[model samples]
Target: MKLVLEILTGVLFVVEVGEGCTVAGLKDAIAAQEELPRDRIIFVLEGDPGRTIRRGEDGVPIVELGFRHGSHVYLFLEPEEDNGDDP
Candidate 1:
């Protein structure tokens, strides 16, 4: 399926994955396409209110979660931790 990832910054990315792709795999695709950290990626599934897909649900396949071709999802990238280097 072809999914559209809209990051918090308004940057958009299109990821192509197999039908068997799981949430974890989807995150991996997003990270690879945008050079982001998979661990920090969260998903707000379209039409699923109050449900934020996270790492714990990685085992679940996206197809089973009501996703289809051209499915749009909001990608929330967890803010990076501020190290001591910050002034």
Candidate 2:
């Protein structure tokens, strides 16, 4: 299945992956293709009340998430947390 990934930077990437690919697998693929860290990638379902797809969730396939060939998903980078080091 070919999935369309729209990064937060307004860049679109098309990746060919199996239908049974897990979210983590998709994340890894996106990370590799985009040369980014997997931990920094977040997938959001595009639509009303867009929800963040957690990478830790297992057993759920991309097909089950309504992702089909040419389906588009929003990819947002996980923001860095403040360490509270500022005075």
TM-score of each: 0.83, 0.80
Which candidate leads in lDDT?
Answer: 1
RMSD of each: 2.2, 2.2
**lDDT of prediction 2:** 0.79
Runs with alpha carbons beyond 4 Å of true place in candidate 2: 84-87
Q: How accurate locally, in lDDT, is each candidate?
A: 0.85, 0.79
Show the lowest summed lDDT stretch of 10 residues, model 2. 50-59
Model 2 alpha-carbon miss at residue 17, Å = 0.7
Clashes of 1: 0
| Model 2 TM-score (2 dp) | 0.80
Candidate 1, which segments miss by more than 4 Å at Cα? 48-50, 81-87
Where does candidate 1 clash, by residue pair? none
